[model samples]
Target: MTQRNSSFPLTRRAALAVLTSALAFGAAPRVALSSSPLDVVATTGMIADAAMRIGGTRANVRALMGPGVDPHSYRQTRSDIVAMTRADLVLWHGLYLEAQMEQFLADLGRKREVVAVADALPEDLLLSHADYAGRHDPHVWMVPTLWAQVLEGIPDLLAAQRPEAAEDFAANWAAHKTELAELDSYGSDVLSRVPEGQRVLLTAHDAFGYFGRAYGFEVIGIQGISTESEAGLNRIGELVDLLVERGIRAVFVESSVSDRNIRALVEGAGARGHEVGIGGELFSDAMGVPGTYEGTYLGMIDHNVTVIAGALGADVDPRGRLGKLATGS
Candidate 1:
């Protein structure tokens, strides 16, 4: 596990609490760990970050899939299953985001605490997953507003499993909610500079429906939701034709998916007379490397906003909050 460089406290007492409790309890206190936040198993780093934000000092959040791990195909290892089995609460993005782990999660839900954070988002905000008819998209965390709703769900999930720290979770959740709202406003203001017509966001996969919904861009994806699903020859040709017709110059590659589909689009467009450029890579399913800017949920969106705006000729500032990356920076 990457040492979570969380801004959350890491005092001697907190470290002692993590160390002593973990060792002292061993397998004996697996029951107690479940009742509260001594040990937590989260599917994605984004969800793990949320659990830490709300779980605070009460729990130690562990991500089963770290940076660059494709969640759609990610399967739990034996150790991961052990952690999930022993965890007080297991938080995942849900909405079929974890295609490979869905069955395990269902069985785990029956036995222990499991709450799909993104599952808590209102149905209207999500686009239906193409593979699973009638099910909504699972990548709600891409948009901060939707993310705030997911964060809010953390306390509700903890309320049943870890009643002892309910108040703490509530307070932490409220503060985090405020932060999410602020991030949303900031993104909106910057993204507002992009002209309405130039707001089309073409990317490697259909992961930005929530982003388009939140920020006013017409999001386009080359591939469907599941990276497991291949983009067909006809689909690629169709997108190339669309790109040339639309005169879209730039399309993005996703962090968690291959650029082959996008490269095919570019070639297809070039053959037809349009020259397409690779826009900056976007954090689709996973974040950037740990300790880097663009690693967290907030930084991921910040990077996307800056990159999209710059590539599309938007007037938004290129630099992110911590000077992570901007058009010029």
Candidate 2:
């Protein structure tokens, strides 16, 4: 377990209480008058994507954290606070993913329909956090199968807000579920092509535990589950030695995390005559630009799988599964 640089104060139960009270108070009044699209504010892009896809015209979704935004350290802006408070439904990925925004979201939940979507995931499927005693890692989106499971109940959530759109939400989710299954298949197929010994995924943080588990990769992160964790020199040195000893050629950088530590590993490996290359930039905590394919959940995982496979010497199309990934991505 890597050392955590900071610790958050609010427990999951207390945070839920704040949000639950708000939902209990806010939901009843709005249920009858939800003819219009539900005004939904999500804390992260991934949640916003699901809301948009499943909620469709039934939800007017706005994501606070955008491309390249790091949710682990994200704080609520004044405008963000305004948007969330005014929205009909507020969706956040719980499990302390929004470490900095927990207290504020909890407080705002007192006045709004705030819900942590990820909290609905089964505890048995979750990986316990290395740094936090009772908390699970918040990056379940890495595994398409697990992500599908997390999203399975989203239609009911959307339907709760707009009962009239329940059928529509379910229809959309059924289609989305098929897409998720295809994504899982594609990921499994491609990642399986990597040789067993080379099936090591080294990244900036331990965000890929689920990915590694779902596929057959060994994951190593310089920092712990939370980006708030620090990677000391000794830790980096150990990884460098591992790289040299194992002949691991590539390590990945993340879109939302600093690449400085990854570069350090490259430099350290170079000094030891084992040249390590940056595998590619993976979307760990954030997706790509909104208009692009990589911006969507499917494309995000597709890009990761394609890049990881291609870099690790597995045969894969550079354009990725849908062949819609940007060239050089």
For each candidate, what TM-score against the reference?
Answer: 0.83, 0.89
Say which candidate scores most in lDDT: 2
Candidate 1 wrong stretches, greater than 4 Å:
1-37, 129-132, 159-164, 326-329
lDDT for each residue of candidate 2 in 99-130, tens digit (9 for 90 to 100): 99999989988988888988888899889865
- What lDDT is reached at residue 169 by model 1? 90
- Where is model 2 poorest over a 10-residue stretch in terms of lDDT? 1-10
List clashing residue pairs in candidate 2: none
For residues 72-184, could you state the per-residue lDDT of candidate 1 as single tens digits?
A: 88988999999999887788888888988999899999999887777666776668756657777777888887788777767767666677788989999888888788778
- Global lDDT for candidate 1? 0.80
Report the lDDT of model 2 for residue 186: 94
Which prediction has the highest TM-score against the true structure? 2
